[model samples]
Target chain A: MSIIIDQLNYTYSPGTAYEKQALKDISLVIEDGEFIGLIGHTGSGKSTLIQHLNGLVKATGGSVYYNGADIYDADYNLKELRTKVGLVFQYPEHQLFETTVLKDVQFGPKNLSLTPLEVDLRAYGALKQVGIPDDLIDASPFELSGGQKRRVAIAGVLAMEPEVLILDEPTAGLDPKGRDEILDQIAKIHDERHITVILVSHSMEDVAKYVGRIIVMDHGRAVFDGAPKKVFSHYKELEGIGLAAPQVTYAVNALRERGILVKTDATTVQEAKAAVLAVWKG
Target chain B: MIRDITIGQYYPADSVLHRLDPRVKLTGTLVYIVSLFLVKNLWGYLIAALALAAVIRASKVPFGYIVKGLKAVVILLLFTVCFNLFLTSGTPVFEWKFIRITKEGLYLAFSMAVRLTLLILGSSLMTFTTTPNELTDGMESLLSPLKKLHVPVHEVAMMMSIALRFIPILLEETDKIMKAQQARGADFESGGIIKRAKAMIPILIPLFISAFRRAGDLAMAMEARCYRGGAGRTKMKPLHYHGRDAGAWITMAMFVAVIVVSRRF
Candidate 1:
């Protein structure tokens, strides 16, 4: 399902001295089956904006529409909306409370009032989708390593069979290998299931590698929203907003500035290498 | 969903109450509470109420915030008023079966409610004006004399300060944990009392584990900082009672005397 946020505004602790405007008139359209990366500094309202997609936070002004239906309409079921747009919060593994990985993964499907057999089937399918071993499903989630626990938590959301999955800093705190493994798993899931994926991250490298579209948020506003390559090309603006383009993009831009004519749009290391080689051959 | 709880919330202000020595404020609260109970008649209660209102206004804390603070003790206030109204034997003004509503009982209930309300407002005023660190510092200084009697005054104050400091951090952690669990379909909102409590297991387990982890990290951090308890520790900001603090105390004493004299009549 496509998501559209129309002139949304959010203020925290309203009518109090601590009142803060977390999101300011943000409007954006997220297409179906697209991999979108949301990048922002701390307290820039990226989290607040995404939370609005699943109805976790009601917009103080304006509305969110899921395929032309108002998400905040009285007839709309928030719980069902959440199931449709699964949100894997930052450091999601800290939420693991079930006895076994299987039970934890089954929790989401069970909430939908699915039959016991269907719950089991979906839980097993989700575990497989996330590449978790069948044998490990019976093991306690708390006993698993940090990466394993993170996978289990993601699997728990996947079991609900959400059409659009929103992950906030999924690769955070993971080692390089673990991060790559998780990102690859996410990419595979997106391709296989044709699900819309919203990845919120601070790492430009991760977004450059995986996301098709990049949305840069600064101070509760969407400063940039376009194709990843196009967004990275605005290097000066990105840097001005306390964000960096991928390292390879920065390197390619530097090379071009130094009279070495190369494609400065290359965001990945391999792409940068190829562009530099092409420049040398010319 | 649990983030909206605003009990004991500190409002950052630069009012006189906020800048006063914490020890002085703490002692002043104690003395003011004692004086509230010493008042008997309607006029005495009115004087005490006016004194409390003056203090609250001088503190520059919003009146709405004081009302919010009173919300937590609404049931207690009601109980006290009801008990004083019904249980205190006096000349009856109205009778209904065994229940007697007396003129004296009505007056007693009104005075009791005012006293309790003022007492709560006075204490809450202290918390609203003082940050947790300042309160703990004042508490340590106030309790310092008990150290000679072998009481672990510093240790207790240290514990209190740490607890207060961690309260907000823990609350934020709990909120994140709850949301994470909710994302995992741990239904915290629905179900009967037993079922809801059962649902909290997932939240509580992680929260407890994380709490223990934080405690371990804190201990290690303290050790790394060469923390050796309060044996030879000196505060960067020592407490000193000024002439203005003395003047304030004297004014409070005079206010208490006026209430005492008025009540005796």
Candidate 2:
């Protein structure tokens, strides 16, 4: 299944003093099983754009297609579209209201009218996927630490077995260690399930390390959409919008500036390592 | 989609009413509401309507915008009109099978409808001109005399302002949580009343939790900065009455006088 957005436009509070055009005439396509990174500055329409994929937001103009079917059609089933395109919001732990971690995760599958046995199985599978401990399954989600609660929230969406998973700033407010753990687990989920993943983050390092494709949004327009290496290579343009490339991109550029030739397109540490080793062999 | 509310929304403008002191606007709104209740005749309503029109004009807020607020109060308006028309007893102006329309009843209903419409418009006008901060500041100063009765007036005002500030924040939070739950296949629409109320559980629980957490954090942050009671606290922008405020006060008094005089006839 694929998702396609064509010439989308969205304006907030039209005809009022607070009116703002959040998304411009933007278009993009998402293929199945592709791990994509969506990055933007605050209010750059990243949140608004992701909201469109699940029909949480309707575009004022243009159209959205899911699996080659127009999602805006009068007869389109939006509830099903929402389930198929699961969205894990920022600080999603705030949405966890169930008594137990297992119950919270099961909420989604149960909403699908699944049999009790299937609900429990999918919930268990999701909990395991997010690496929730067996002992904590019956524990109140509210009692868990911040990171644990966040994982349960993600499990809540994952239990639905969505075809596409979109996470908005999943690592926000988490420490570096927690951030790495969540992203790595998401990568594993994408690999194991072969489901499409859209990771929305403001952090350059987080997206560069995991996502194969990066879409850069600026002032309601997608400024760059390409592989991490190609997108990060325009570090100058990225820096102009209060964003910078990953550390390795800057380090490689710095190396080139200091009269040592290195592949400046390297966006991650491993790629920088390979480039430096190649230069060292010379 | 919850952004359609127009009541209690401030309209930014540099008109006479907006430039006047918020205390004047507050007092004007209170007196206007009281006068609305006091008036008993068509002449009184006409005077009140004129005053409202003048205030709206001076407020620089579009008349249509002020009228939009009446949408929420439409049912109440109709209820008031119907009760005064059919239930009121007097000389019959029109008669149908079981329906009786009396001359006095018709007059009462007309006056009642006008009174209600004016009440809503007059009140919303103040909100359109005065922002919440200015309002709280005005209320705090106005209620300062009540501090002698151990009312914790300053703290109450602070709490009130904070609550006002949290409305939009909590609304945005509600939107986020609702969408998060919806993404989990939670159906909020297409349900019976009981089912719909149950659907709200997910949104309400998280909203209350987050609101309390925010309150706790705010209390700590205030305490961290050595915030004590209101005794020694000074304002960043103190409320002061300008010439425009005095003029507004005189105009409000005159508006009340005219309505009160017209009520006597």
Candidate 3:
């Protein structure tokens, strides 16, 4: 279940007045069940990279292999590739169309050509996985709150039972509570299902909190790919490319500057606090 | 799929036609189209072609670019040609079963094909040179007299401009929604007519919702800024006629007169 990207390059509106190379030569291998964060500034090619993983957008050059199968092969089934690698776009709430949340969530499973009973079961299981309440299952998705509608939209993709789930800026525009709730639910789901989850976000903190591995994209190139601490260490370079490290990274650094000697690589506030406490006890 | 829609697309360039008053371009296009229909004989058509050639030369838009617009209208041209070739009854040039081609029918078909090609070429030139804002401003100014007859000319112009502006946004929305659905295993390409159309519902719904939401937001934003229609509105860049605009009107009149005289004499 590994995805191997080989020297991918993509140009938008190629050869036209508006031609732009959105993704440059980049290669990486993502192992199965790895929780990865794909973060970058807006228009940094993070979204484009994620889209290529599922074959939504074909790269202008290079190839993508999922589970030892070349996706760009002549006979490769792109439709089936999409099922195994589901992508939830930004502002997923706008994708909610069915009258009821249940029906909307079932849309993906139905498209998979599952039996009605199996579709309903998958939909229910997905909604449950997302922590959507039972009372809201039959409710009109449009009538729900913004956060609830977004959850239903996410559930739509989750019902497809994709081995790899990719979400693009899923917490964008949500309140902090809503953002944390969604991210917590995602982390819990990833823990339970062990599906490869790639969360694309602009916020470093959000990625730092959950993902074990973080890939930082700069102008269509993956400039850094490693554990959160390793990526966060190059905060200054990331800021040069229009991305700031999480606030906790700065605090940890500030403490070490003040001679407190806490670990500077603490990615989250809790990690920073624990590091500070450890230094104090010593 | 969205890229196929090339209508009303403006090609920006600095040229005599691009600088001309949009009102002049609009009226000239109308008069030019009228002249195409007014042409009755081969001589009239020759003069018509000459006038179009002159206009196109002055427009500074590339010849190949103008002809490219015909790609979308060729079907209509062929349809007109086919009907005229086989339907008009006259002295038969050739006959085979129910298929017939007559002397007059052949002439009519050829003439119609020329007229339509010229028509598309002429209007496309106008759109290519004039921006949508200028088009609406010209439309509103030209139709201002209708306000006395209870026509909401300003409102109509505003609506047209808004619709034009929303087209690109809606198209982008459609593309995004289509991709989102496709990622969920929605099959849009490999289906029959009905199945394909049914697949479109997922995309169409979100697009319409987003459109309505945008419209609502725009209306609210407009109202917040005290936009109450054209009751007492004044233009930030009010249009004025230059010496060249009058010159263009006279030139257009002369062109049409030539076509009319050729047809009459």
Candidate 4:
């Protein structure tokens, strides 16, 4: 039900002159039904870490446990593990290959050896979860708007009925409205399904708003792991690693500098608004 | 699992072979391959092998890395050896129904195997030491005479370099697409040949779309950069021949001389 990564290390092209160590001794526990944000700058091993979770990339050292069972052990079924822990990669829309959106969404469940009826059912349910209109479901995914195409792609993973859903930069390359919609839909899925959700992103604001806990990775190590408020309070140290809290947190800190009483840890627009209102009323 | 492809891949290093003029390396490879074929006896082959070993040592590229390039042509080498073993006419050492192993056949097979290995290794050496840009520059320079015959030599060289550059990029894209499909419970393994081929459709379609999209983007970029046809082009850093290049030519001349003398004897 939970994933425990112990001392994971990965090096690409080991022993070659082009060898590069991508991940270094990264150990963490993702408890059941937890909404976690894994944030890091580019080349910070974020993609490599998520790939390890689903067994896409094997760890050179250490082990990953799913529900207290070592996933890398000889007996574990890798396909079953991949289904249980779904990964929606960055620019996931490019993965869509079926002619129609519904067919593309059904690809996952179909591959699970489900009955055709069951596969379609799961696909329909996933499409509904992602809120794709029925008419658009019959249209070619390539012909849809960029945002719609992305939703279908997400639905493709959602149809797998994974217990632990990991999204790597799910809101990347989306317009502001599209980004908000995706974030809200992801939050809705987490709440309704009660599944463990790990969002990998570099946009500090997006993760700050939704994820209860944030794990900040820098140079292949999780440097900070705590609640969003507690982590954002260390904004100075976060910025040292090329990361920042949400703009509102900076704004709140600016207001505090003028001797106004406000919580400097506010990350979302609503939290900043409420904090400002509270100070004004006081 | 598909990352083992090393064809046309360059290994950057600071060594005499790596720093040699691309034209010299290219011409040297050609001469070396021709000389490898000219070897008539064991002594000639030994000389050629020594020359190859010297080049490998001077390049500072790992001996194992250069040897690994031989893996790509293993099947071809085996086929040539097999063909030479059973087909060449000579005094028979072992004879069976429709199968004859002769002394000359054995010698021919051995020599052909060695020649093929050297051929692949020699070409791989040139590519491993030379960057794609330099290779294209050398190729365009070598083919510059073809321009007199109305051939678009520059464009042809550009195409070759672009194709060479995109090999790794396309492989990376294929890897990503395969992983994406696998995440969705697609099993690429554990299938019969036909079933496995069917499974590849999901990967192929997306890869092709992305590749075409990339091609379009690259075309646009080239056009935006005002990349006209190679007519009236001026080089940014024109090819220069140093004293080492002269030494390289002398060495090539000596290699050819040895092969000529071996053939004469």
> Mind giving the per-residue lDDT tens digits that candidate 4 earns over B56-76?
899887888777767778898
lDDT for each residue of candidate 2 in A1-282, tens digit (9 for 90 to 100): 799999999999776667899999999999999999999999999999999999999899999999999999999999999989999998999999988899989999999999999999999999999999999999999999999999999999999999999999999999999999999999999999999999999988898999999999999999999999889989999999989899889899999999999878888788899999999998
Assess the local accuracy of residue B261 in candidate 3 as a C-alpha lDDT between 0 and 100: 89
**Per-model DockQ:** 0.57, 0.72, 0.59, 0.77
Ranking by lDDT: 4, 2, 3, 1
DockQ category of candidate 3: medium
**Chain B of candidate 1 versus the native chain B: what TM-score?**
0.82
Per-prediction backbone clash count: 0, 0, 0, 1
Q: What would the TM-scores of all predictions be?
A: 0.92, 0.94, 0.90, 0.95
Clashing pairs in 1: none
Query: Model 4: clashing residue pairs?
Result: A1-A67
Write the number of the candidate with greater TM-score, choosing between 3 and 4.
4
Give lDDT tens digits, candidate 3, residues B1-265: 5643545667677888999888999899999898899999999888888888888898777777677668778888899999999999999999999899999999999999989888888888898888888988999999999999999999899898788777667877888898999988899988799999998889988888999999999999999999999899988988999999999989988897788889876
Tens-place lDDT per residue, model 4, A118-235, is 9999999999999898999899999999899898999999999999999999999999999999999999999999999999999898888899899999988889999999999999
DockQ score, prediction 4:
0.77
lDDT of 3 by residue, A58-80 (tens): 89999999999999999999999
Q: Report, for candidate 1, the interface RMSD.
A: 1.8
Best by TM-score: 4
The residue-by-residue lDDT of candidate 2 on B59-132, one tens digit each, is: 78877767777887889999999999999998998999999999999988998898888888888898888888
